[model samples]
Target: MGIEIEQKILGHARDAHPHECCGLLLGRGGRIEQIRPAANVHREPATHFEIDPQALLDAHRAARDGGPQVLGYYHSHPTTLPEPSATDRARAAGDGSIWAIVGEGRVTWWRDEKDGFAPLPYALRDG
Candidate 1:
């Protein structure tokens, strides 16, 4: 992740405040080129998030058209640590997508694996 993207995630979390913010991680290889903020359409926005299906579909379509790859997803925890919560673990598809969880003034990365989420260390690359 780039420092700018990290800042944006934190900012999104702050802006969402009581509700969780969700979005897409867009890029290729080891670089994240953009963050697309998506509407959290979950019924209980305060505790969970469901990225608008349209946003996901659009991202895939764009990727097929030579846009950035759909690297993974991101969401905020609001009141918890930046680690994956039980709810997160349960919802993960284990498709090896990267997940960035923002909370408590920090951000943590994880790789959703078949067993569970594994901590993923990332360096902030200069943009």
Candidate 2:
């Protein structure tokens, strides 16, 4: 992930404080090149998030047209740790996508594997 990208994630989290902010992580391979912020359409935004379906569709379409790939998803945990919550685990599709959770002044990455979410380590780089 780029340092700027990380900053944007943190900033988004801060801006949406008390309500979960969500977005798509766009890039190729292992680098996150951009973040496409989306509306959280969940009924209970304060503790949960649901990225707007239209946003997901548009991202996939863009990727097919040679735009940045949808590398993963990101969301903020308003009052919890950066780790995945029970609700997150229950909703995960086990699709092997990267997930970035932000909270308490930090961000943590995880891989949604078939079995479960595994902690992932990432290094920030300058663009």
Candidate 3:
């Protein structure tokens, strides 16, 4: 379940970096969510990812069409690790948000926990 989400995000992140890539989260039940690219705002996509507010809202609305909410947001740390950077920590995608940090051309996801972002490292599990 987790691994699939990471893979989906990784694909978008790698392709979207060094600009921030965003998308709607799709899935059934509460597992197997997929990341689908929306649109990015940052024109200088080399070291920063800028998401348009309208685009994000649109994505969220679209997800509702599929029975899911925003589920938080994701962006990439180009040429870096999947680990969250200081910026990522300071301006996290919100407390309950799911942060997907894609680097090394891969994806690693974290869930917002009271202790802060907890790694939900991509893994495959049988349904």
Model 2 per-residue lDDT tens digits across residues 1-127: 7899989999999999899999999999868899999999999999999999999999999999999999899999989999999999999999988999998989999999999999997888998
Flag the better candidate by TM-score, 1 or 3.
1
Q: Each prediction's TM-score against the native?
A: 0.97, 0.97, 0.72
Provide the lDDT at 27 for model 1. Answer: 97
Candidate 2 accuracy as TM-score: 0.97
What overall lDDT, based on C-alpha atoms, would model 1 receive against the true structure?
0.93
**In model 1, where do residues sit more than 4 Å from their true spots?**
none
RMSD of 3: 3.1
Total backbone collisions for each predicted model: 0, 0, 1
What would the per-residue lDDT of candidate 1 be over residues 27-98, giving only the tens digit for each residue? 988578889999999999999999999999999999999999998999999988999999999999999999
Tens-digit lDDT string for candidate 3 (1-127): 6565666777777676566676655555545466657676666666666667787777667777775556656777777777877766776645666666777886667887666788875557643
Give stretches of model 3 more than 4 Å off.
2-5, 63-66, 125-127
> Relative to the unseen true structure, what is the C-alpha lDDT of residue 90 in candidate 1, on a scale of 0 to 100?
92
> What lDDT does candidate 3 reach at residue 117?
84
Q: What C-alpha lDDT does candidate 2 achieve relative to the native structure?
A: 0.94
